[model samples]
Target: MAAAEVSHKDLETGPPTGSEKHTNGVGSKVKAHRTKDAQHGDKDLLQNVFIGAIDAGTTSSRFLILDGAGTPVAQHQIELDQSYPRPGWHEHDPQQLIDSVRECMEKATADFTSKGHDVSDIRAIGITNQRETTLVWDTETGEPLHPAIAWPDTRTQALVRELKEREGADELRELCGLPLSTYPSAVKLVWLLRNVDAVREAYEAGRLSFGTVDTWLLYHLNGGLEEKSNVTDATNASRTMFMNLHTLEYDDKLLDFFNLDRNKLRLPKIVPSSSPDAFGKVSEGSLRGVRITGCLGDQSAAMVGQKAFTPGSAKNTYGTGCFLLYNVGEEPVISKHGLLATVAYHFGRDKKPVYALEGSIAVAGSGVKFLMNNLGFVEQSHEITDLAATVEDNGGCVFVTAFSGLFAPYWIDDAKGTIFGITQHTTQGHIARATLEATCFQTKAILDAMAKDSGQPLAELAVDGGMSASDLCMQTQADIINIPVVRPAMRETTSLGAAFAAGFAVGIWKEFHELESINQKGRTVFEPDISEKKSAKMFKKWSKAVEMCRGWSDEDEDDASDQE
Candidate 1:
């Protein structure tokens, strides 16, 4: 990709100073006009200002440098250390998350500058992070009072049940567009406040601050409480079970339901996903002086990167977990089905916030991780697809990847990871194929539920993320769902999404329509190869396996209850 041909800075010289022209279409008050670079005088002043996106994912942290055309120029990633001290508990050191982000940014920026690109040309930083991962930190010292509670942590299942048992608990769905689930940040926060003495003491002393990874990153980036750069985007705030889907702000009643006192517990101010200056600048580091311009939750950022901006547009991201989001336009649609209602993205003020219905599958690429790390089936994750490709099919094997139990449409808490119909004939390839097929089966289930909840059938599915890199898995997904699976040329759509939001905010791309022609090279499409009847038959077997695995945890729990 060449330079942007035209620069926003060059266009500013046109007309009288402070002229108002909507150059970038809707809501842009910036002066908009094409002008030859008078300073360079006949030479092209390469629109070298690149946008950087910090992808703080579940398992790792990544920094991607994207040009005006959404092409990655440089990238660096660091795998995060995850701790599981107890069964079904997940946590990450808050400082570790911040350190990973900093390292990624420094490494990526070093690469960017080594390529003769000016570090000063890095205009802004965008942040997209794992949603619902709760963190509470001290205001003065900028240290986490407790480890960042991972989004998948189910330690609060009992507390969630207590909330559900409370009167008016059912009204939370209507109030916050979320169910009383253990996945939400509020439940995790409640657990921290109740169980962790440090967190409770911090809150009581009015020095506690709550934020997801995005807000945490922003706080540190902007120099912490002294700089007062604690702000979360609408997309990230939507996952907290505190923000109102309609107002796009934190609801008092929802906060009260969680028993959170705002005065004692300082929450980040909810801001638009993309803004000119709210998130503040990187006060220090190699990328110092770069402004933090855009922020979004990971799934919502994936939606933006895939350009699923229209009503009924949908995309599935197969990261550590898989998330399928169906865009429902400006209005939030509360899901009667098992899906979650969330803000897809908000460009800025005056632009309507896009809403979505999302179905989250907790075991996607991580299932492959289990094969690589726990079972030692493969040296690397990519080999699972290669091993599976050796076998024509699953060989009558069915794997229910419920390591953390099923999510979305099938909220089966009692199920564990199960491999059914494993005969002597079952080889490594059979198990490998079954594992990959398990994700596809769950995806098909989510898609079915999405269609039911949204009252709209998907024409095609746009996919990105680590697992979508496998052609076998994608083909299996297409076959199981009987829908075309579309993948972008650059599979780093998650990072690109954050870049897009940042670039748009600073007028690099000018308008949303400008992105339609970008990042389109080498896009692949997988059409359904198997017959619908065959798909149905295979899915029926998977459904049966899912049923067979249910209540494995419950039986033990029931025995314990009886003993009590």
Candidate 2:
């Protein structure tokens, strides 16, 4: 079949309802993304059939159509505008996300068709989203109650501090494998309830629905306005403190402790990572009626794409924030260190789930953004990579890119980003090099903590994503941790992971063994080249930089004044 003819008016941006309805802003962007011409192919397309996967991330929304070989033949992506409404408060116009998804899907599908590849062959779709960004909407209208609160928002810092002062701090961590930090969704939910009048009234009226991005997108895609139901995958649900680690369900104690009504809020049904009905179908768009079969949090999805199912497989993603996940096999093991327990992926039916240990660094690529935006360093981010690659070494420099705070193993929210070991000899090139080193150092630290918690030695890591594209960064990661760092020829592993999940769910792919059967070729491995002693010395300097940044807060009085 030739590519299905889709029109701009087939769907209009309104409030989300079943299948295709979306918010007004989303419709406008779709209006803006209108393309006039596309290439037409004469030769027969490549021989294959596959599924579509949507990878919704912090900075971008991407669509990937993957074949049985796990390679994306055509992909399209669009970046969303990330807004800092206030200091330490992060938000996204939920419409931007919705429209971006539509735009990406249209472009990707258009590309495939222009190449004579038929869209009918796409069996299903998977969704992997930036986890922990909270959205509450009207179950009836499918309208977002407020701009989506990003995962890194510190508005809940005060709430977290108060909760930590309570007696149940340690117990909560033991129960949830997460500390009393503003990072978790539970505290964020509390802050929203108390501060946002719309949310409070909606909660009382029983019209409020809450979910992470995946749930919100799913609802909108499936007929949001009329048949709105909040639901999420196990991988995303694990990030919320509301869910129990063992049972993978929301805990009554957690809800009561937060003083939240169990029924007042719309809670999505928690489903397996990989299952057929686990995801719903997109009711609208060029690919309307496409089945969304797989879903995972971006990190967990990346874990799947990396094939880190067996014990010891690990990887790090460098994006707006840094996340390092290590697959730990069958059962969930609570972390002794300041690490979060997470689900790697759910391959089988309700029984025998796989688990993982994760260490999150609040800022990685965001640190680079800070350097470019705040400090006025290089013209563009790509320039930083080129400059860093210029230096043979860091020239005895160490940079702690903790502009926000440190996470995992340390959990020091009090620290600030700092540059250390700078002297007359230091240059921007060295500074750039140190910035990349800072990320690698923190990654190694989190991986170490994951090892200690899981009691499993890490094997070679498989990496993907924008940051993993850097050869210098990859080599540095290997040299610092003294392990082989593997980068896939195709770096969109997060979407690949979602596609795999959806494919498995729809029976297009039977088992992990079948997915593994793909050649999985062109993996570049960066083995340890630096001496262990040199690595240790570099770490010692990085450690001191962190210590110097400790207690970078202005004053307790400032925080108190803000509250008043």
Candidate 3:
């Protein structure tokens, strides 16, 4: 079938086409409908066909219900409780993750029904979650053996250093497209096996199951122990350091490097990001009986949501951290410039999977949070942009926001947060502006590295997430990077991407081109407002700051050693 060409107004107000029909899972024709209310006009009209997206992110769990047009009709979100028992450790209660998702689904569904919609209209559900956060569980009891080791946790930093010295350590990147770093699931899994008794005992008893956040959500959402839907998509699996980049499967050699036994430990089955039956159905909840058809890591989902299907299309998400993913087409391009190669998405079992080069920054919105919570510059994160706008410019100040350490392109593990060119004239506004510019500088670095690796210059950058909501921040990003920054009016592209995947599986939208008008209505484009030479000069000063900031943490470590 040819892709549909619907207008944004038509999609929002009425069906795509008159009497347009699509078949659901059971092969029954589902027609779009619009009923008018005497009091509310088109407000009571229902699409009658919908998709649900379960977005289990790092800080929160969100459920969004989208119509065929990709507009989020109803949604609910809940912040997750985070635990940090040690200095470099971060964890989450496994049950809280599950409960949060369930509550979101229930509440979102309630909101949908209250809008004069039917629950039966929701055909399929998709899931997108935080990548690389490791979870281990007892297979028999289906209880988590340990607290979920969060992706940002640095407890494995010492372990990573030790592993880098081991033989065959240098060869891992060629196989898995990831370096021996503290981010991947393999390192976190190894840490748990060595440090946690419950995890080790479960592993020894042949009852341990290892999974990322996506797999953990799938297992419980599909009826927990009864269904045991232990599976992960390629996008999430690619971040684990266990999955082979070429074959998209777990490698035995990679397993040997981590001293993992595939026989004893239960690994989630790897599946395509968009599949009709691979992920199984939602066994219970407000979404009970709906087939769970799509899954992707949050970044990958954002790429899909932005409709960045063409090669050379790139996106930058400014959340707690910043992730820049550049699409490299079907074949994976192993980065020679410190970027990680990852699966972009796999729509079906037969179709070839697309790949991307990813560059991650350790801090973006967190830098804003630090300014709010740590420095007391503002009452909320969004206010930082206003504070930044008070200053005409950075006033010769540069803030290297390496709260934990720099990541991607630089990978400077020993660097600490530093403010360079700070003078007595530096005010709170100057500091706030410099903090925002820190993310922009890192994004420019990653984009440069991506161009070097893929041999493709980015024409523009599509951006979303919490930090992207600020016009000043995005405008600064455009000025620094010298590229057009595109932000859609519907900023929940992560959830929309999951809905797109589920919609694809159920024939609601047959091809990517059908999504041409989905969320393209009211987009704000930030052009490069500054001169190119000025942007370059500003970046050069930032580069100098990065180099000077190195070894700051190393000096602190040395002082601690001397005291000991």
Candidate 4:
């Protein structure tokens, strides 16, 4: 944990002075953006400069202030409520998200402001968020008509079922590179219209507008209460099932499929994921006047955070769930595997887009949440890592954390979470190790599918997110995949990724080479030390456990299936 606590200030790229150069992956030419208390006499060496980034995630929202090169100087974070109104229902107060954003910004900027940091030093803010969570509200008043429906909510299962029965169901996946799951916004929109009275009336009156969390926050953050500034990045727009992947605009077929009127519904202007005119300036609060310069779906930002821009570079984020993305460059490849084609980022309306092939696991960190809260295996999330480290191995146990069904590669939505290979000899340590192993197994499967679809064999995987802090889990990941697991010196990669996008877009920084030079900060590379034979043996056992977990409890399947 001490090793993980080190910051990556040493690796940040230099400010954009024109030449796009990088050395060993860190930016050079130290320049002060945010004041670092001039305690450094001539003898003290200068390092990174400061920038701001905000990351909106599923479980919480955080604000980070990074220096010129890409290391977090100070951060503020808050966890919001997760509402489960009923079985398979998940929601967040849209207003809560808005309030949380304001609060977090205040906290992160408090230190800078207190020290009398120059406002000019803070160039812009980059925004990254949980993709596909739906937000809809009145256009004029900026009031959410209903709670924001989260991506994990399966209340839209019936809606997804109906869509599948529609004529174009089969082609939706090929067209959108996404299956007709309850996760996307299209079905959620349908459910909201049917079930929520306010949504129905708003839609009928043509006063309703919808967007992902990024759009919602940006709308409010950019003076929505006073003026209209609502817009969404292309990456967020693509997940809505309404946008044409190639055209980067709303499609007629999708509108017809979801029974949505483009004009009636407020759609954010599609902007480049990185751009100057694309994002709005925060109108109020401590971050007031700070240009909102960058936006991307959280997963894409995670890939960027890992600096996986190079082809054949891959990353998997261990969060409430897990997502693996392989950077496929400018073109979006329609996935042959059960994965999705996504825009990594469009440098904000001007720069050509970066694309990725993504596969997700619906239940990664949430599985630990279950053991800690539901099953009482541990006291807190951090303790899970320590408990797992207690065991030399899983002791012939395996767990398929399918609490909410499997995602990516498998797409086994009907399956529930399961523990496999449990015997009388099994101990708590085995279960703890199995839980961690579960994350790695699902990650490997997703990466394999990603590789198959994108035609890129990853040489290494750069990982981040909450769970990536676990050394044991990272080592397991490296050993299982037979590739080096590179953990960045800075763990707050999400916020840094957002800052990078915003800074680059505004010319605070220029090319990837320039960003690369800011700093390489040190990295912990976990190599595959296990023999191939041993690796194969564990995988075989893990595979069998996965099969056993499938088709467990037909009654529950029937119940969940009947709801659809």
Candidate 5:
């Protein structure tokens, strides 16, 4: 729980076998020859290759040092101080974002060295961050012009409505692979230009620099204005609604549509997710001079971490919010469904960019957090699983978790969080079960949409993040989706993905096949237990609840307008 605490638990769930031999920076099949005096065995040889990953998430900044086997050697995490000045407005201090990362790196590096490992062995570092969080800074001074507008912030809701009616709005999605919504950085940047005086003035003066969290962190981590390592990967740039999905570059048409001048505003260069030289080195820290080789948006990194490289492979991350991404292969699929299309990851400059169809649920683990902190249903978040298990089923209850409106296929903005079928027979267990089922139902819906868009059914769902730790929840998910839910023993796949990217760029692993055994040990597979008829009945009831919950938020808005 402490920020500087170091976890020493063995992350590998099973004992190493004879086949799990060490590789000396070559592919997995080629074994490293051991010297006669090698005392630590494979682990000592593994110490020769380690990759560092900096995970800048929604609520925390973490640094993880992982071995060649994808096991974390040392790590440190620090919770971020989030500011919600008004409802639907989330902001983070730009300085604190990089500061927390630097501190985490220092602390994690200290832990790594204290364990008798050489810090110089950290061959390359990678960065994975929360995507679409917009930041602007002065090009001359390298100081943030305003607070970082987080991805979840809905401050541009009214602006989104106006933009949707604009002439070129309909064509925007086909070009950028994103709908005109409050989620993208383009709208956020437009809002700042219109409202924030400092940002507007800087933009007008041609001294403004715009970047997502990745670029901001890279700039500071690589020695700020002096080094000027202001660049973002294709995965992050794809979310900005400014980059062309096919070209992987900033589009002039998109800039014109958003009314942004390329001459006036300095945007970060779009680079491959895994490159040996694109991301610069850590300027001054415990791992100073180490090359930062790989970078990805968190979800993309998680996909790589899960090794979901093949087409039709899908991953569902149930964090504060749920994100379901289905790999559609090299070409980007412009979603006919309510899902968003985006780049999955691009390994190198020459490698063709892989794309995915994304479906975002506004509430997942946050719904569980509401149960623990708001409703006092349990003392801890994980206890909600225990409470739900007290009931065999939801007892005819269905919860529509639309706390800040639903996303993905439904796109129901006028619906609030609603629960239905509450009878005298319903108990806390029933509600708890329904709460867990809400995420599962949404995931099933997203997968259905993805199947429609890509013409490929998801064979198994690779899951991670906080909510995936619950066996009851994962089992429910498996039952509802009628597919196997695969969970790796090492759930820190986001960090591992970044490390893998860095490792790949530096030739620690030569090919994708070489990473097959890295984090595959002791994985759990939850099989579908319920009958298809039973699953269909439950899903139908959930659909009815979703329809019933519509217009609740709109009604509240109308009532407020009447009062005014």
Candidate 6:
């Protein structure tokens, strides 16, 4: 049978009724870009099926289509607009996020067909998203009660402190594999229930729906309230502070600790990262009717994309935030250190959940964004390296990027961003160099802690995400860590991970080793070029900066003390 031709205009679709509308930015219709110039083949294209992945990230929404061999056939991305209403608070228009996903999927699928591939060959769709970003909406009206609370938002710090004071509050670490911090969804949800009038009313009326980005996209992609496609993968659910790490289900004690009335809010069902039926089918757009068979948090997806399935293997993703995951096999290790114990992946109910110790850095690529938008140092993010290249090094400068406080190893909540060793010789280049070096320094710190936590020194660190594109940054990472830094030819591992999960469900890829050859044609390895003494000296300077940055938030504490 011949494949049907799809018009670009036919890709535009409407949102759920009563949902907020979005203004089209690029074009009125979904656009297409051919991945290859090959002619159509006469064989049954269904046998040569492709898989799709939706990477709903903090900064952008991306859609990727991959063939059986894990080669990308089509790709499209649209940057998302995030609003910071106040310092340390971030938000996104939930409806706009859903709209962006639909647009990217439509455009990328159109591109797949333009390359002479069959869109019908897209067997299933997978989702990988920014974890811990919380959202709530009206179940009946399909309308968000408040803006989506971003993962980096720190509005609930006071609440976290109050919870910390409560007896047995620390017990939650063992239960949920997370500390009582503002980063978890449980605290964010509590803040919303108690503060937001709309959320409060919805809670009282029992109409509120809560989820991370994965659940939000899954809910709407499965036709919102109509299809009741409210589900989240185990990987995404693990960050919620509600799920029991042992059972992979919401625990009653966890709920009671947060004082959440489960009857008032609807929690999405926890399913495997890759499932045959749970995620449901895409209701509308160019790739309409495609089943969403897999879902994962962005970091877990990157680990899978890098094929870091074996124990002791690790990878770090440098996105809006930086996340390093050290795979710890099937058993969850409750972190004694300030790291997080999280589910790496869950193949299915029959298989045990893979676990990892995670170190999260709040500012990474956003440090570059600050230089671009806030300081006017550059117009584009990639231009940051050029500015940094002007300087020999950080010029004896150190930047401790604690925009939302620090995470992992040093859980310093009282610290803010600080720049040290500024003099008459300071320039934008020095600051840019310091900014990029801050990330590398933090990566070294996390790896140090990972080595202690796992009892295994990292052989090499596999890297991905936007900032990993900078060779200067990678070399600096290698130099500071004194370990080789590795990156793939294609840095879109987050999206590829989702595609791998979806493809696995449909039998496109049989085993983990089968994906070993995907995108292996060209791999870049940055070996450590600096002596250990020099690396230690550089890291010591960074450590001094971090130490000095602490207690900067004490003024706020003093103001609160005065009120008392």
Model 2 residue pairs with clashes: 17-223, 17-224, 17-225, 18-223, 19-222, 19-223, 19-283, 19-284, 230-268, 231-268
Ranking by lDDT: 5, 3, 6, 1, 2, 4
lDDT (C-alpha) at residue 87 in model 3? 55
Alpha carbon lDDT at 90, candidate 4? 78
Writing each residue's lDDT as its tens digit, candidate 2 over 92-175 gives: 899888888888999999998888888788988998998888888877678888898888877665567778887656677656
Give the lDDT of residue 445 in candidate 3. Answer: 97
Residue 250 error for model 4, in Å? Answer: 1.1
Worst 10 residues of 2 by lDDT: 1-10
lDDT of 4 by residue, 199-311 (tens): 87888888898899899988888888676877888888888888877778888888888888877787788888888766779898777788888887888777777777776
- The CA lDDT of each predicted structure is 0.80, 0.73, 0.81, 0.73, 0.82, 0.80
Better of 2 and 3 by lDDT: 3
Regions more than 4 Å wrong, model 4: 1-49, 348-350, 551-564
Error of 4 at 480 (Å): 1.1
- Tens-digit lDDT string for candidate 5 (37-125): 21232455655689999989877889999998788989998878878776567789999999999999999999999999988889999
lDDT of 3 by residue, 126-213 (tens): 9888888899999999988889988877666667777899999999999989887777899989888887888888999999999999
Question: Candidate 1, residue 123: CA error in Å?
Answer: 1.4
With a 3 Å backbone cut-off (N, CA, C), the pairs that clash in candidate 5 are: none
Per-model TM-score on C-alpha atoms: 0.90, 0.88, 0.90, 0.88, 0.90, 0.90
Using alpha carbons, what is the TM-score of model 5? 0.90
| Segments of candidate 3 deviating more than 4 angstroms | 1-46, 554-564
The Cα error of candidate 2 at residue 205, in Å, is: 1.7
How many clashes show up per model? 0, 10, 0, 31, 0, 0
| Top lDDT model | 5
Model 2 CA deviation exceeding 4 Å by range: 1-47, 348-351, 517-519, 555-564
